[model samples]
Structures are given as C-alpha cells and as structure tokens.
Target: MAIKDTSETVDNKLEDKELDKTDLASVTNGAILGRDLTPEEDRRILRKANLHLLPIMAFAYLFQFLDKTALSYTAILGLREDLHLKGEEYGWASAIYYFGYLVATYPIAGVLLVRFPIAKVIAITMFIWGAILMFTALCRNAKDLLTTRFFLGMAETAIAPGLSMIVAMWYKRSEQPLRQGAWFLGNTSAGILGGLVSYGFGHLHLLWGFDDSCFHHGSNLSPRHVRDDRFLTKDGRAQAVARVETNMTGIKNDKWKREQVMEALCDPNAWLLAVAYLASIIPNNGLLTGLGFSVLKTLLINILPSVFQLVFVLISVIGSTYLPNTRLLFMALNVVVSIVGAVMVREVDPVHKWTRVMGCALGVAFTANFPMTMAMVSSNFAGFTKKTTVSAMVFIAYCAGNIIGPHLFFPSEAPGYKSGFLAVMICLAISAVLCIVLRFYLILENKKRDDAGDAIEVPLEGINLSDKTDREIPQFRYIY
Candidate 1:
C-alpha cells in the first residue's frame, strides 16, 4: 500500500468524528441507523425535535390561555349583571390579572429555575391556575372577581417564560421559527375552543328542566329544604339555592409560594428580551384582547355570528401554524393587515367585511409574534437559569401589553374602533423594524464568530466538552 502522511490520517479522523456526531439513532438494538449523513440530516433532526417539542409546549399554552381567557367568556354570561359591574370595571378586571402576572414574571424566571425542576414548577403552576379558573364561578362581586383574576394572573406568570427556557435548552437558533409557530397556534386553537365553550356555557341556563333562574324546576323539595321551608313558611327553593351557592365555592388553597418563582427576575438577558417583547406585544394585545371581541359584536348585525367567529378561528389557526420566519413575517403581516382592515372599515356594504377584518386581524395580530418572541428569547439565552430569566422578562413586557390593550377599547371608538386599529398598525410597523434589526444583529454576531474560526464543532456521542481542547474542536456559533 502507498504510505499516507500522518497529517492526512489526523484530518481523516476529525472528519470521521464529525460524521458520527451527525447520524441519527436506530429504533432497534441501539444502533446508528443512518448512512452518509449530510446537512440535510442535521435539518431533519432539528425538524423532528421541533415537532416533538412544539406540541407539548403548545398544549401547555392552550391550558394557560384557557385559564387566562376564561374570564372573557364568563363576562358574556350573566356575570356582569350578577356582579353589578360598571363602566371599565370589566376592563379593569381583565387588566388587573396582567398586573399580578407582571409582578411575578421576572421573579419566576430568575430564581425559580435555579431552585426547582422545570416540569414540576410548570405542572404545579398549571394546576394552581386551573383551580383558580374553576373558582371564578364562585365570585360574588366585582371585588371578589378582581381578587380572583389577580391570583389567576399570579399563578400563570411562570408558564410562558418557563416554557421558553425549556425550548432554549433543547433547540438551536435556526430551529426556532417553526417551533414557535406551532406553539402560537395554540392561541388560535384556544380562541376556537373558548368561543365554543362560551357559547355552550352561555346556554347552560337553558339546560333541561332548568328555569331562567338557572335552577332545576321540580316542585318536590328535599327533607332539609322542606324543613327550612316550613320555618320560613314557603317552598324550599330559597334554601336549595343557598345550598348550591355553598357547594360551588370550591377549593381556594395556594399551591405555590412566592419564593418558588423568584429566579426568573435576576437576569440581564431577561430585561433585554423584555424590551423586544414590549415592542412586539403592545400592538398584538391591542388588537386581540378587546378589539377582537368588539369586531365580533359589531359584525353580528350584518353577518351571521357563527360565520364571523368561524372565519376568525380558521384564519387565526392557519395564520399561526403556517407563517414562516415567525418574527419578521408576523410583524410585517400584522402591519399590512391592520392598515388594510382599517381601510376596509370605510367600505360600505361589502360582503363578509367582518370576516375579512377578522381574517386580517388573526393573521396579523393574534398569531405569530407571541411564539416568535418566546422563541427569540429561548434562542438567545442558554442554561436553565439565564433562559428562565429572559423568559420572565419577555412575559413581563407581555403583561404590560395586556394592560394597555383594553385601554384602547375607548367608548368613543365603539362600533368602529378606528383609532385603536390605527394605533396598533403603527406599533406593528415599529415592531417589524425592530425584528429586522435584531435579525441583522444576530447575523453579524454569527459572522464575527465565523471570522474568528469558531464555527460550531459537531461532537461525537459520549464526547465530553471538558476533554475537547479548543484547538481540537470548532466553536459553535449562534444562528442569527
């Protein structure tokens, strides 16, 4: 055989190591299954990881959204009448939850991840919020409602940031957009589920044998009620009503302590992400929070209410799931949709105008920005501690936008929320510019690393980072 240089042998070994690192595992017998792996193999792995991870995160967010937006659905029933709420009382009730969320978000991100397991913390928080949501039915007055909403906010503050941290731990930068899109599709799904649940709950008072008073209409009375009725000299209906009220005040115990969520607040990256989140989320909240409901209400007059809601849900689902390049695409789409929708508001007697407006709003406002923001924060930060901190900061900004959203629902802009829509359009434009800038910044950072000869090294399985000398491995650069 011809003699090969030692240098050539060393280069061949390095190439072999890289190739081994890039192969996928086989299902049976724990073997390396694939052959001749390429860049496309790396992409496939990323896509599979995203597919597995995004659905889990999306389902988690679906429950979070249900817990958060349950109030909006509840408001459609007799809650306002029963609670005797006044002007802006509903808005305040909705906004106050975000205030509680804001107070807790950073703390959860910075401190909690360091102290507790992520899954445990997230599950506990989810259970707490779910309990809070179930308790909302028991709220007797505006004060009680506000208190409940505030606590609900507090319980939910951990989920968004915590999930972002999880994503960062598992994924690379280029893999974020599609994963983020999948997660945000949950929001769209939540809308559909919320509307259906709301419509069903709204009709609960009409269930079989139930009177308009939401009581079973049997003349027969129980022994306890009958006994109480004799003393009051009337039927036992009032006593039965009292018993129902007592039974409905479900469990009200606090599941998580303040100290448990303190880690999320301590990071610098959290603050940076918060700035980005604030820029992106303000307009999103403005359009989706109150404007969506208002548009639905107005369009019910000319359009079939079912058609309008169906269209809204469909648009939201498709826009959220399908959008590529989540950060830039969502922001750009939002601005264009808002401007077009606003202009369309002036169209007299256009068929399905409400549907058009809703489709645009769902595409622009409700879909992509949320997921992208979370993904961006996750991609930028690393380790559980720093990731949690950044995630919390992003959500804190999200809370600010939530607070600001309802304020845009001015009484003066009733029927047609022109000013609010226009304002959101401007905000969307600003966010689009910021996203582009951030993209460029990331690109520059990656380029600098490449220039320094620090490109990512693909390590073989069981290779330890500590064992690999700097000269032996290429640097892993972040994707912009």
Candidate 2:
C-alpha cells in the first residue's frame, strides 16, 4: 500500500511546497504502483533510451567538433594568406577561441542550464552557433577571424557539458563509458570527415568556403531532431527515470546550492581530474599540415591518425565496460601510448615521414582518456550543481590547456616543432601519472568508507535523490 511516484505522478510534485526544488518532480510525487524493476525490464528501458538519445547526441557532438576545428582546416588551405595573418596571429586566433570558451563555461552553465530546460538551452545554443559559423565565412581579416571565432567558441561551449549532463541523466554508471565514448566519436568523425571534405575542397581551391558551409549546415541540423520526449511512452519515461534512481544522482534540478559549488571547488578528486584533462588536451591543439605533402598525402596523413584514434577509443571504452575497475587503468595506458607516439613524432628522422605519421596516430591514443574521465565524473559526483560545477572546472582546464597549447608551436620552428612535440610528450606523461594517482585515491577512499561501515548497498527506493553531494552521502562509494 506504500505510495510511489512513476508515470501517474508526472508533474504532480511541482505544487508541493515541502518538496525541495532540487528534486526532479517526476520522481518525488506519489501516485503510481510501487515495485522494483525486473532485470529484463531494466534492459528494455535502457535500450529504448539509447536508441532515442545517443544518435542525436553523437550527431550534435560531431558538428560541434567540426565547427570548432574549422579554422585549423582552413589555415592549411590558404586561410592564413587570405586573411593576411602574420607571425603568431594564426596561433592567437586559435587560442582566442578557447579564451571565449573558458570565459563562458562557468557562468553560462550556472545560469542558463539551471533556469531553462537543458534540451532547450542546448537547442538554442546550437542554432546560435550555427549562425555564428555562417558568419565565419565573412571574416576578411585576422581581427574579423578572431572576433568570429571567439563568439563561436562561446556559443559552442554549451554542448559538451550539456551532453555530459544528458549522459548522466539517462544512463547508469556501467553504461556511461560506452555512451560517453560513442558521442565523443563525433570528435574522431569530424577529424576524418573534415579531412576528406577539406581534401576535396582543397582540389577545387574552395576549402574555406566549404568548411564554413559544412559547419553551419551541420549545426542547424541537430536542433530540430532531438526527439527526447517522443522517444518513449509516458510509462517508458517513468521507467527511464526509475532505472537511474540507484545512481543517487537526480535527473534535473533547477535550484542551485552554493555549498555544492564550494564542495566541487574544494574536492581533491575534482582537481585531479582537472589536471588530467589539462595535460591530455594540450596535445590536441595543433596538427602538422601542408608542409609540402601533396593534398592526397596530406589527406591520408590527417585521416590515418583519426582512424587510429577511433579504433583506440572504441577498444578502450568497450574494455572499460566489460572489465572491472579498469576505467582509470585504461585511461593511464592510453596516455602512455600517446607518450610513445609523441616520442616517435619528435625523434623519428624527418626523411621517414610516414613513420612520424604513425607516431602522430599513436599520439592520439590519449583521446580515449577524456571520455573515461567524463564517465568517472558522472559516476562519482552526486548533486546536480556540484556535478555541473565540476564539469565546468574540468572544461576550464581543457580550455586553458588548449589556449596554451597552440602558442607552444612557435612559428619559427616551421616543419618540425621540436619544442611543441617535447611539450606534448611531457604533458602526456603527467596526465598518465595523475590518472594512476586518482585511481589510488579512489581506492583508498572506498576502503575508508568500507572500514567506517558506511559502504552498505542500498536498494533503488532506499537511495536518496534529494540532491546531496557524494561527500554528504556516507553510503556513496567513489568509482574509479
């Protein structure tokens, strides 16, 4: 006879004054049948959400990556000459985009996502970014390019964190790695697809025009297609919310908690993850292009690395899903592979260009580390505000690294940016070490909880979805 919330209770809790605004209304109201889901029922619901959610997520993310990297592609195809860019102007243009991204991530996440529906915010931002990308086509000088790139960065910043939040909302911890990686393959797809598109346009001497059009068109496509509500019946929506209850991380919470912001800022684990992100992203800043290689060879060289990264990301995420407690371990291993790849790029004789290209492909192994870390945040962090804050901080680190990363490729270095490659190798090593440290820290924290008799497993109904931080929940165990 116990009352519970499910399909019948949808929107009923919105009028309850006693209920915390931070609680998801569909979850806290009481009106539906009370029962635990069977294993088969759980799988059915998961599959449905995956089908409806992931494709749109992946497609949106693919366009985001392409839009962000369009400048780099155009640079190789005469953007520098056409814009009259000089010395470090090109690097500044690249770095300035991230400056807008860094400036916008925290405030935008804190304000817009909390006040508006997440899907709506994402959709609107997508439209804005698409318009901004179209504007990139009209940039006739370095100042114009810099101005357009900055606004584009601000517009696009919402997508990555927004997508991460969506993954946490719909999926469980066990499902997060693969789902996160699946969407992130947008980055890999952009690389491969962008290279092919750029290669085709390069032959026609129309690379910049096509890059702008592709970015704009791709951005505009995602807003109308996100059918999140239509994916499931009313009953299926309840089941989707119910299945993730054991996560103890509530779906969507509008009310911000100042204490949770401080918690996220002070958490040692958050900083560790931030450092890992910072080190890993520095290497992603620049790629060798158009140093005298034919457009065909340049296309091959650009695409080969993305293909290799695609393979490595798939293997790593799948391995994380099937293997127990191997998420951080695999992340560290990929970073090591990247280190070896960086060394190969730096030390290999220039005459052996293909060998260096192979190294470049291997250098991207660390790409998998990012989704792994995002999964860790989704699995480990509780409370919507805290989780969002942590995500913003990590991305700020990401933006900072990207900003600093391009400048490391000194214009004087020309074909072989030895200094830049060396920096890449060092940062990759640091990231690998930090991943190991984080794993140990999580292990120790879990052990302490177990010793304190606070690690008891709870049923789905027994778990608190009241927007508590992981630290406040003694039963919460940190997952590596």
Local distance difference test values of all predictions, in order: 0.49, 0.76
Candidate 2: deviation at residue 444, Å? 1.0
* TM-score, structure 1 vs. true: 0.64
Tens digits of per-residue lDDT for model 1, 77-136: 556888899887877888899899988776665566446555556766666666666566
Can you tell me which runs of candidate 2 are displaced by over 4 Å? 1-19, 22-24, 28-34, 202-228, 290-292, 454-464
Candidate RMSDs in Å, in order, are: 16.9, 3.8
Compared with the true structure, model 2 gives a TM-score of: 0.90
Report clashes for each candidate as comma-separated counts: 17, 0
TM-score of each: 0.64, 0.90
Q: After superposition, how far is residue 199 of candidate 2 from its true place, in Å?
A: 1.5
**Worst 10-residue stretch by lDDT in candidate 1?**
244-253
Candidate topping lDDT: 2
lDDT of 2 by residue, 139-256 (tens): 7899998898888889878888877888888888888999999999988998888888877664322343344344444433332211235656666666666677767765666777
